[model samples]
Target: MIVVGAGIAGVACAGELVRAGVPVEVRERGRVPGGRLASRRFDGRPTDTGAAYLTADDPDFTEVVEGWRAAGLVREWTDTFLAYGADGHREVSGPRRWAAPRGLRSLVEELARDLPVTVDRPVTSVRPGPVVDGRSCAAVALCVPGPQAAPLLDPALTAATRAVGEQRWSPSLATVLRFPSRRWADFRGAFVNDHPVLALVCDDGDRRGDDAPVLVAHTTPEFAAGHLAQPGAAGPPVEQAVRDLLGLPEPAELVHVHRWTYAKPTAGGVGTYHLDDEGIGLAGDAFGKPRVQSAWRSGRDLGRALAERLLTVGG
Candidate 1:
């Protein structure tokens, strides 16, 4: 089996298949795993620029989070976030969000530690035999955003093609701003509603538990759409928006922006995963509410389903 993605979803699927006594390989186009759980180092410190944080509610996913917590890879962030809208800024309580001291990417890396994962190797096509780039496999799982997966799938594979076609995605930009010191009121995270440029912002220092005077902001889909070509160009505006929202006195000393063309699914899928007679599987956050847990569950369910089918056929 081949999983053509190294994100949490892909790694989770591979883990299940391996437990089922199925040999599997993971291929990733990027230099590292993590996908949207992306984190980047700036000034010798890891900052979460992709997903602000994650929440766990499912019993299975809660167990996974507990493992991450015991391994010192994750920490309970906060249940409350400040929401800024037309009226004013107010604290909103929600589920307990989790964060990683090392960065969310580390969690994905930990899961992939024992898997046969190949980085920087992009799979070009998934053909009729469920072949990956001309190599026939027992099965192939495309654990990626539907927009990205759509291009790699051959039109001859109707089941997978139709699945990808029915999905819709949106884009966003994550900006990291480093200031001389923390000048704004302390807040873990903030939701900027009705904002022209910014959508969400997090105090990276607080989130990382490092006290580093750094802030990470996500741009609205509408704003991100215009700056998709050059995400770096969005840094100034994103930084400005953050400063304005938080009423910071000084400008950021440094700013970095990362682009997410398909940041999230616009709507949820009908099922947790998709598997067909073609022996191709599709799993990702798109399969349910777009979240870290959703991606994990989607891949896990798909892996179990595939293992049953393969084992039965072999028997």
Candidate 2:
């Protein structure tokens, strides 16, 4: 079995296959795993620039989160977020949001600990017979964003790939700012409403429980789209918006901008996964809700189904 992409979905699927005694290899284009659950080091501190937090209401996912919590890989970040608009800011409470001290990426890395993951080996194409990058495989799982997976599918699987491609994915520009001091308002994060440039802002210090005076902000999809060609160009507006939102006089000491072409799925996924008779499968957050837990569930379920089919054939 071959799994493309090492995001949560891909790692979860590979983990299940390993547990089922199936030989599997994971290929990731990025230098590291964790596509959206990305974290980077800024000024020697880990900052979550991609996913804000993990929220789970499903029993099975909650149990998995609990296990991660027990292992000290995850912790409850917060249940409330401040919604900012023209009127004012209001606190909205929801399910507990989970965070990892080391970084969100560590969760996927932990799950992929025992799996055989080949980083920097991007599969250029997936043909019938479940061939990946011209290599024949019994089964192939494309656990990446729909837009990304779409181009890789062979023309023969147009129906499957087209359905995956048609799914709308919104882009995002994440700006990370490190201030000289924590002079902002006393809030973990804020959802900016009616903002022309910014959509969300998170205090990296608060989210990681480190009080590091770092802020991570995400631009609106519209704004991101306009600046996709030059992601760094989107930084100034976002920085200005953050400064204005927090009533700050000056910019941060350091500013870094990152671009995500397929940040989130605008619409719900087709289903848990798309497994055609050709033995080609698609699984990811795009196949369900745009959530980390959903990606894991989609991949796990697909991995189980593939394992059953393979086992039956072997028997």
Candidate 3:
């Protein structure tokens, strides 16, 4: 099995296939796996710029999450999640909101390390041509975001692959702030409801690591949309919004803005899609209603579907 893109969905699919005794090779465009579930460093502290926490709604994901928790790859951060309510910021206590003791994204990176992953090798295109010059790939999985995966497919079957258009994703900017000391004493996390530019503010040191103080503020889709058209995925609006939201007195020692051109799901897709004709399949957050659990379940389903198809073919 050849899985394109090493995000959680891709990793989950490959991991399951490997467990089924199927040899899998993961091709990732980035230097490391994890995709949107990515982490970065600041003054030696690792902060997740992508997904903050995951809430498992599906039983399959819950079971997988349990294993992850046992292996120390994941942990229950909290039962309550802070969101904007009629009051201002209301703490809705229900589902188990999980985070990494280190960084949420690190879990993916750790699990994918030993696997056969080809980094920095972006798949330019895929056709019906031979897998090994004539064999036709036993199967190919395209796990990249929709906009990115569309053009890389063969023109003749582009419509079938046009399943890409069935989905839509948004962009966002993450501005990391390292304060001299702790600022907000309310809770570990906060959802800024009324902010024009900022959407979320999370204290990195609260659950992940012990440090002086660090805040990772995510920009609203409206704000990120305007800035995403720029060349690189970084800029000033994101930084300024972080300071404005927290009312920062001055600049911190280290400041970095990471703009995700493809962030949230604008329009949710089906549970998941599989293209058997060309031996290609697709999965991601956009594969369903935007959520970490949705993405995980999508990968799970994709893996099962692929394995079933492979079994029908032969051994």
Index of the highest-lDDT prediction: 1
Q: Pick the candidate with the highest TM-score.
A: 1
lDDT of candidate 1 at residue 293, scale 0 to 100: 95
Report the error of model 1 at residue 184, Å.
Answer: 1.1
How much lDDT does each candidate structure score? Answer: 0.92, 0.88, 0.74
Task: Please give the distance, in angstroms, between residue 2's alpha carbon in candidate 1 and its true position after superposition.
Answer: 0.6
Q: Put the candidates in TM-score order, highest first.
A: 1, 2, 3
Residue range 108-189, candidate 2, lDDT tens digits: 9988888999998999988888788778888988898888988888889866676686688999999999989999877888
Error of 1 at 208 (Å): 0.4
All candidates: TM-score:
0.99, 0.98, 0.89
Q: By summed lDDT, which 10 consecutive residues of candidate 3 come out lowest? A: 128-137
Give the winner by TM-score: 1 or 2: 1
Question: Scored by Cα lDDT, where does model 3 land?
Answer: 0.74
lDDT of 1 by residue, 1-315 (tens): 999899999999999999999989999999999989999998679999888899999999999999999989999999999999999999999999999999999999999999999999999988999888999999999999888898998899998899989889999999999999989878899999999998899999999998899999999999999999988999998888888888898999999889999998987468999998999999999999989999999999999998999899887
- Residue range 244-282, candidate 3, lDDT tens digits: 655667666556778788888787465575555666788
| Rank ordering of all candidates by lDDT, starting from the highest | 1, 2, 3
RMSD (Cα, Å) of model 2? 1.1
Candidate 3 Cα misplacement greater than 4 A, ranges: 81-90, 129-136, 209-211, 229-240, 247-250
Candidate 2 backbone collisions, by pair:
none
